[model samples]
Target: MPRAILDGTVLAESPNTVVIEGNHYFPDESVNHEHLTGTATETVCYWKGTARYYSAVVSETVFRDIAWYYPDPSQEAASIKNYVAFGRPVQVEL
Candidate 1:
């Protein structure tokens, strides 16, 4: 199983994850919404389409824009649509 963690807390965990470019994309249902705060930040990936970010807020700490997902992905990355991927302060453990 793969899990997304922040500040020792599991933000998301799933066995059915998609690995793209070595990043584990966890299913939406596996994520803990309480720890995620939607952000205005957005980035475009040539093959993945536009990605929207989320800040991981745990206790008194905030990991800004550490997680992202494509709400509507390009055809090439349709399988990862709505799946979340972590980076930086958010740790992905396999």
Candidate 2:
């Protein structure tokens, strides 16, 4: 199982994760929605399409743009569509 943790809190965990470019993309249902705050940020990935970001809020701490997902991924990366991946400030454990 792979897990995403922030500030000692588990944000997402799943056995069905997609690993792309060394990052584990956890299924949407496996993530804790309570810890995520949607952001207006968007970034384009040549292969993955546009990625939307989320800020992880644990207790009183907020990690901005620490997580992202592609709502509609490119054909080559369709399997990871809508899956969440963590970046800096968010720890991922496999």
Q: Every model's Cα RMSD, please?
A: 0.8, 0.7
lDDT, model 2: 0.93
Off by over 4 Å in 1: none
lDDT (10s digit) by residue, model 2, range 46-73? 8889999999889798889999999999
- Winner by TM-score: 2
Cα miss at 51, model 2 (Å)?
0.2
In the predicted model 2, the residue pairs found to clash are none
Whole-model Cα lDDT of every candidate shown, in order: 0.92, 0.93
Question: Which stretch of 10 consecutive residues in model 2 shows the poorest summed lDDT?
Answer: 85-94
lDDT computed for candidate 1: 0.92
Candidate 1 residue 41 Cα shift, in angstroms, is 0.5
- Which number leads on lDDT? 2
lDDT of 2 at 90: 80
